[model samples]
Target: MSQSEQPWWRGAVLYQIYPRSYLDTNGDGIGDLSGITRKLDYIASLGVDGIWISPFFASPMKDFGYDVSDYCAVDPVFGTLEDFDQLLDRAHGYGLKVIIDQVYAHTSDAHAWFEESRQSRDNPRADWYVWQDPKADGTPPNNWQAVFGGAAWTWDARRQQYFMHNFLPEQPQLNVHNPEVQDALLATARFWLDRGVDGFRLDAINFAMHDRAFRDNPPWDPAGRTITRPFDLQRRVYNQSQPEVPEFLERVRRLTDEYGDRYTVAEVASDDPLPTMRAYTKGDERLTAAYSFDFLYASTLTAGRVRRSQGNWIGPLEEGWPSWEFSNHDAPRCVSRWYDGPDRPRFAKLMNALLLCLRGNPILYQGEELGLTQVDVPFEALQDPEAIANWPRTLGRDGARTPMPWEEAGPNAGFSSGKPWLPVGPDHPGLSVGVQEQDLDSVLNFTRKLLTVRRGSPALKWGELSFLDVPESLLAMTRTCEEESLTCLFNLGAEPVEIPEPVNLGGAVLSQSEGLIDREGRIMPPYAFVILRD
Candidate 1:
């Protein structure tokens, strides 16, 4: 199919906005729908096709916005439903699709459904959540551990039973296997679709269901990996990624299909996520795309790693499209995770070019275009539950969730007139949008140019990726679409490497590096990349 005839999201770029950190227009130190509306122009200027706003639903601030208290109401902190409508309208006005998050796996303990479910054993909503009776020994239903820490099942005195939670105790797991629960979740989707949302990013959909038998999760070997929490020691077979999860997704797909061209992407995170990701998006009956933790949590970015990750999705179209992200609200920034050198600007540009040239859709986190690195959030000010639970061992996600720095000089780098909920990175002022807007050579400007180039090229936007035979330190590939082709080369190592013979380097459409390229096969500088028209 031609690029113009393909689905709008097949190879489109999405910008992820963490609502709490994007911009706080209310001076309450938190970003709201109105704040996002105010920044629509800036996001549209990034050349991304859509904006994936993290949860701004009715949340109780536990686990931030991930724990939804009400599926159909906007949290008072994020303004009213009218504010979201205005934001969505403004985003569409700027030609940007707005995709909101749907946390179907669980809801805040404060949610009316969960509250009613936990009230009594015989309540009308007793079975609305995953409630189970304790064993004769008074232990949890089984050996399941929460993602944050401790036992996954928490005791409830009222019901005298235990409730399961994949992440936090305050966020109880929902009984999505129940048809009624599925109907309610689908109704929530219909509510947003009725509100004119372009799509939904399903949060941890793999954890929506559990083993009905409540079997014990098999033990997992650390295999030279650090053991942070008890949850890390289990293979996580029984607790999540159940066989029935995809069946629920089929219903979600059918509902979304009712709304034309509506996109649905699921966040599938587990020990082995590729298979589940594929299953969740295998055909038109499931999700449009799914992204895993392959690149999100990687400590290093290498040619072989990228090859393996991309190779999985390079088969037939029925295998489904994948979405790649180098940074997001859940993990540390990529530039800081992958590179630890003095010349971060050059490395940032190289990574940007590499991401945009990949085979599938690319999701860019806010402030990524400006080369923002992870901040160092102190323990006293730590806001993330996982970070506080596993402190001093993990770098924690708070660093990446810091507020975006808009101006060089401001109360909180222009993120808010008052103190930001999270501190802006100390070094982010130098990389602020105001600073980079004037510099043509800045990473921000380079990102704009790179995006424009990708959008204009059919091969780069909707192409088949084939890795070239190159050294381990180098990643060379070609994105071919019908008659158009482009060669993408990246030096993923510290030392320079030579470009092999027979690889075309004549038409250098875009290049980033401190080294030179010549006709006789020149040495590519450390972290350099070039995109050539073939």
Candidate 2:
């Protein structure tokens, strides 16, 4: 398809808004749908093509909004369904697509389906959840471990069986293998589609299916690595990543196809995610795109890492599109994880440029454009259940989930009239949107310019990518459309690096470092990057 005729999501820049932290319009200290609507103009100013709002469904707040109780209802803390409709209409009015999260793998124990299923074995929805009988010795069903900790199977006395849970005990696994359960989930999706949602970001989709036989997962060799949780000690051979997952995905795609131009992207996190990511989005019958934790959890950013990530998606026509995210609500902010140098602002701009230059859709998390750093949330204030359970060992997701700073001076940085549900970062005030708006050289403005360039350039938006020969510290590649081509170069290291002799540095279209480029073979300073029309 030609660039203009392509789907709206192809190579789109999606801005992710974590509803709890984006902005709180009500005095509840938690952000709501109305808050997102209030900020639609600010989000539109960033030049993003769409917004991906994380789960705001009715939940018990055990895993935040992940443990959903009612699939169709909005949590009272957020707003009513009417509020969401207004947010959707306003977002569309700003020419931005709206993509909401769908947690299909499990639901809060308080859900009517789970509540009824656990009441008795002969209940109509008894088979809707994964319930297994105990072993001969009265031990739990299998060796599967929950993602949070301890045994995956939780004992329910009413049913006299151990029910499965992949995360917290409150979130029970749904037996997606059951045709009735699949039909119900599809109905929920259809409900949203009818309500005018442009797409869905399927959360932890690989965990939706499990091994029906309840076999033990083989022990995974740590290879001298210190294991944090028992869950990390197993290969997860049968707990998830079932062969039938693609079949279910085909059904999801078919449902989405009914809504013209609708999109679906799966979030797949595994020890080896490329294979599953490929499988989940391999063809037209599956998801439109899928993203992994490859870049999210990386300790460092390097040329080879970027090359391999990009190279994996370059393949035959049957291969599905990919989505890339450097930071999110779950992962620590990239500025804190990747670079600790004095010149963090420079590094942030370079990273932003690199993300937009990639071939796939680039997902920019809230506060990323402001160069936000991970906060050091204290033990007393930590809210993440996984982190609380494994304290001092893990860097808890609370640091990354802190409230976004909007003003330099405020009670909680103007994120709320009341104290935010999560603490705002100490340094976030200086990097607040109010502070960056006045400074033209700020990372926030630089990101806006870079996004504008990407939106206007066919090569950056819809081009095929090919790596160019360059030094170890530098990443060089070319993005080419039919008649347009642009060369992108990044200096990932602390020291200066020279471009190879064969490459042409051509006139700079967009650049980070001021005095680094020259007509002669150019040298890029620490964390510098440039894009040139070739």
Candidate 2 per-residue C-alpha lDDT over 1-534 given as tens digits, one digit per residue, 9 for 90 to 100: 577687898889999999988899988889999999999999999999999999999999999999999999999999999999999999999999999999999999999999999999998999999999999999998899998899999999999999999999999999999999999999999999999999999999999999888889999998866576999999987978898999999999999999999879999988888889989998788999999998998888999999999999876537878999999998899999999999788888988999999988999999999999989888899889988998877745889989889999869898999988889899999999999999999999999999998998888877888998888888999888886888898889999888887777865665555455644746777788889887
How does model 1 score by TM-score?
0.98
TM-score of each: 0.98, 0.98
What global local distance difference test value does model 1 have? Answer: 0.89
Clashing pairs in 1: none
- Pairs in clash, predicted candidate 2: none
lDDT of each: 0.89, 0.90
Looking at model 2, residue 270 earns an lDDT score of 89
Write down the lDDT that model 2 would get.
Answer: 0.90
